[model samples]
Target: MRDPNPSETASPFGPVISAYSRADAIADGVLVPVPESIAKEAGFRFPVALTSAAWADCVKWTDADSEAQPTPQDETGRLWDVLYVTAHAMKKAPGDREFEVRLYRVPRDGSTGHAKPARLKSVIGPGDDLSPVITIMCPDES
Candidate 1:
C-alpha cells in the first residue's frame, strides 16, 4: 500500500536526510542535561536541559573564578539561579511555549565585576521521543 505522507515514499525533491535529534545533541555535549530533581524543584514538570553556550556562560564556576572575583560563586548556586529565573518567566506566560528570560550571573572569566545581566531563551518542545521537554539557551542560539 502507498503511504499517504510524501516523505514516507520517495520524495520528488530529493533523498531524505537524517536530522540530528535531541539525544544526539546531549550526547555530543551540545546540550547539558539538568538533574530531574533540580528541575522539578524549580517548577519544571518536564525534563530540562541547557545549551552548552548557556551552561558555560552561567553555570561554569571554578576555584579560579572565585579567587578572581571579590565574591565567591559556585556552580550549584549559579545553576539554581538560572533555573529559578526561567521557571518564574514561564509562570508569567503560561500559554507560551517559547519565551526569553533575563538573568544575572557572574562572568567566569578573570574579570572582577558584579553579576552581569544576560538573556536566555527557553523552549518547551518535543524531545527525541516526541515528548515535551524544555531547553534553555542563549537568545542567539537555536
Candidate 2:
C-alpha cells in the first residue's frame, strides 16, 4: 500500500507494489508490509492475479550504446530501494479456467534509475481479479 516513488513528478512504469509481513497477513488478515529478508532472497511468488495492468508497469533502458548505459555497479544499495519486477506472468490452470499470477522482483531499484518506465506487454487487463488468489502483505512503513 506504500508508494515507493522517489518524487511525485517522476514517471513510474506501474504502481509500486508493497509487501506485507507474513505475520500480519495471518493475524489481522491484512497484507501491506514486507518481511525484512525479502530483499536478500532471490524472489517470492504468490498465487494472486494482477487483475489490473497497472501493476506490471516497468522501466527499461533503451539506449543502444553500452558505454552510456548505467552499469550495475552504479546501483549498489539502491536497486530495491525503489523496486520493480524482474519477471511476471499470468497463466490459466491446466484443468480449470482459473488463472494464476506470478511477480518476480528485480534486484535493483528500478523505480528511479536512468531507465524509462514502460508498460508490461504481458500484464493482465482490468477483467481479472487477484484479490481472492493472492495474499497481500503489510505496508513498508507500517
Candidate 3:
C-alpha cells in the first residue's frame, strides 16, 4: 500500500530536489505584491499578488505608452481594472478556490487600439505560511 502522505514515504529517486516557495518568487521579482490597501478596496481579504507576466501585460504603463497610443491611460487605472474585474468574478463564484477571470485592458505595446480582452487566472491557495492568499496570473503562467 502507498502512503497517503508522500512526505512520510521514502523516495526511490533519492532525497528531495530543489523547491521554490512563494516568498522566493516574490523576492525574485517573479511575482509582484499588490498593495494591501488597494487589494482590500478591491474586495480581497487576503494578500494578493500578480505574476510578472501579468503585470507586464496589464499593469505596466508609462507616459511613453500613452503618447504612442491614441487613448490616454495610466497604471492606476489599469491595475484597478484588473482588480475590479477579478474581484467581481470571485464574488460571482464564492465557493470556488480557483478560477479563471476574463478582463479587458489596453495593451501597453506601442499600438493604436482599444482595450483588448485578456484572461487572468485567480487562485486562492495556501501561501508560504499556509495562510490563504490570492494570486492572479496570465493563463500561460503557473
TM-scores, all candidates, are 0.88, 0.18, 0.86
lDDT of 1 by residue, 1-142 (tens): 7678866677677865888999899999999999999998888899999999999999988888889888798999999999999999999989899999999888876775788889999999999889999999999999
- Model 1 per-residue lDDT at 56: 96
CA lDDT of every candidate: 0.91, 0.32, 0.90
Candidate 2 CA-lDDT value: 0.32
Of candidates 2 and 1, the better by lDDT: 1
Ranking by TM-score, best first? 1, 3, 2
Q: Write the per-residue lDDT of candidate 3 for residues 34-105, one digit (tens) a residue.
A: 999999988889999999999999898999898998888999888999899999899888899888899888
Structure candidate 3, residue pairs in collision: none
User: Which of the numbered candidates is closest to the native, going by highest lDDT?
Assistant: 1
Over 4 Å off, model 1: 1-15
lDDT of 2 by residue, 1-142 (tens): 6668658856576665875544444455332323435533524343322211122222222223223434432332222322334222223333232232234323234333254433222221222233222322212111
Go through the candidates in order and give the clash count of each: 0, 18, 0
> Candidate 2: misplaced stretches above 4 Å?
1-92, 107-142
The runs of at least 3 residues in candidate 3 whose Cα sits more than 4 Å from the true structure, single-residue gaps closed, are: 1-15
For model 2, give the 10-residue run with minimal summed lDDT. Answer: 50-59
